[model samples]
Target: MPAARTRRARAARKRQRRMAGVEHDLSADEWAGLQEAWGGCAYCGASGAALQKDCVLPISRGGRYTVLNVVPACASCNASKCNDEVTGWLRRKRLDERAFLTRLAEVHAGL
Candidate 1:
């Protein structure tokens, strides 16, 4: 069973590497920017929860996983956004960048 689990894990890692190439990991600056961008849940504005690194621009659309192109988002938001551009995802949720950023800031500041 343990060997099977290890094999599955290795297979998953290989698949991810093949799919993402060298863009699977985020850079240091990009990570910091994500923390700043998505201080909490984009939906209910919750904070201190686990965050997922999300692409402001989808990699499929030629987006780099760089600082300016990444944002920290709650798991729910990340799942909801899927592979769409961040702007479009926000719009679909009836949110504007300004509002979203403001809320993110507020969540960060805990104000």
Candidate 2:
């Protein structure tokens, strides 16, 4: 039980540090817009699956939960992508890396 408690405390502290000084947090409206704009999982194009907020740059690597960095992903893709850089992960998954990048850039430009 003491070990479990220590793990939990460490996890909480890590979350706090990750969130510290996080400006430009995504708002409800921005999230809705993202969903509409992507129309599916941003990585897998899995429409109608429950979406999770995924950071293109992992929070552990200094990414913030901001509009520009966040994308909607299916649970499968989100879990698979944990803490990995987006382009490399996409390549490993055999996904269309260039298409994703171009679409992301177009979306960012419109914002």
Candidate 3:
């Protein structure tokens, strides 16, 4: 048997979690934002991948629970990001952060 550390625990847990559907914890707008993502990862576009809830502006950095701050990210992206701010992480990954930039601008502008 494989050691516990070598086993795919997150995947196993994900399978178990699917039956319950992870959206129960989200607000109506958050669910809308998640559904708008079309089940693929919002960042890397990995289809049907196991996803995690991510805050575009991290709570630790003084972000809020507003729907605009939430996005569905694949487990790999989410774990790699940890508490880092969203736009900076995207920049470090060499991806265009324009959409987020516009959104952040709109948010700060009270849109």
Candidate 4:
């Protein structure tokens, strides 16, 4: 368990380093607005759970924590989506790829 925890911590640090020097313009108000707009996990539509700030493109893949790149996601979806491209991960999970894309575009437009 300790080793697992250490490994996870190391991976998180690496991700942080990868994110260094990248844009991080998502604000608190923007996060609130995003949650309100989505009303749940943006991918799975699961409401009433604490949402996480998930990058549409993972940080490891050069995605920043910017407004257009971030979305509200449930813990499960966030964990499952670790380091994967959004569309392919959604497809693999049997999620509505087109719908997510459309909604994402709408949300970004509204922002």
Candidate 5:
């Protein structure tokens, strides 16, 4: 049988594919970075006690369900960031855009 963590990671990937577009198919390894960010919101460093997968770029703006775009989030961060430009939203929240971008770049690079 597959391990529980493996199963969750797979589920996350499936969700990503669904988010990208119904016709778009994807695999788990695409966002393996999510496993590393499992415990907290990649945005505010908030505990992802209830983790949310947020797209860095809005799907409306053509964000794909790819590792480079998705990041772990807490419920609040995800809700507040909904559909806004990431940098603009982060600035409105008084969050550090540079740091978040740096972290995201690292995650993308690792992939």
Candidate 6:
């Protein structure tokens, strides 16, 4: 049983690594879209000088280069949100997501 468990663990690790390919750095347009989507930081609602670009899908999770998966977030919020998906992260922050998604669609549609 112990050996079987070890094999299963190894297999799980292998599967994760295989699925976790690298993601490219966000592009100019993608960054623009993200800034527009967040209208500032998605977490704390900060805008101006310290605003930063964040990856919606983490590179460690094989996030592809897509505009739909990035957003602007302040440094503090970015650190807090980290690699979590937008919906999950925002829900944890108790943010209203309806408007965000609507804007996201508009931004992506134009791209």
Cα shift from native, residue 1, model 6 (Å): 39
Q: What is the model-wide C-alpha lDDT for candidate 1?
A: 0.68
| Superposed Cα deviation of residue 45, candidate 6 (Å) | 3.5
* Per-model TM-score versus the true fold: 0.59, 0.86, 0.58, 0.91, 0.70, 0.62
lDDT of 6 by residue, 12-51 (tens): 8975675555545567876776676567776566778477
Model 6 off-target regions past 4 Å?
Answer: 1-25, 29-39, 42-44
Per-residue error for 20 in candidate 4, Å, reads: 2.8
Summarize candidate 5's per-residue lDDT along 19-53 as a digit string, tens digits: 65733333576544475744478878976277766
Candidate number that wins on lDDT, 3 or 6: 6
What would the per-residue lDDT of candidate 2 be over residues 49-82, giving only the tens digit for each residue?
8999999998888898889999999999999999
- Report, for every candidate in turn, its global Cα lDDT versus the true structure: 0.68, 0.92, 0.64, 0.93, 0.75, 0.70
Clashes of each: 1, 0, 0, 0, 0, 0
Q: Among all windows of ten consecutive residues in candidate 1, which has the lowest summed lDDT?
A: 102-111
**Pairs in steric clash, model 3:** none
lDDT of 4 by residue, 42-82 (tens): 99999999999999988888888888899999999999998
Off by over 4 Å in 4: 1-6
How does residue 25 of candidate 6 score in lDDT? Answer: 57
lDDT of 1 by residue, 5-102 (tens): 99999978865765577465566765765576655665546689888766667665666666555667788888888778766678788867787766
Root-mean-square deviation (CA) per prediction: 6.4, 2.0, 7.0, 1.5, 9.7, 6.9
Using lDDT as the measure, what is the rank order of every candidate, best first? 4, 2, 5, 6, 1, 3
Candidate 2 scores a C-alpha RMSD against the true structure in Å of 2.0
Q: State the number of backbone clashes in model 2.
A: 0
Per-residue lDDT of model 3, residues 48-106, tens digit only: 77766777766556555555666667888888787887777888977668865664455
Q: Can you give the lDDT of residue 90 in candidate 6? A: 77
Give me the overall lDDT of model 2.
Answer: 0.92
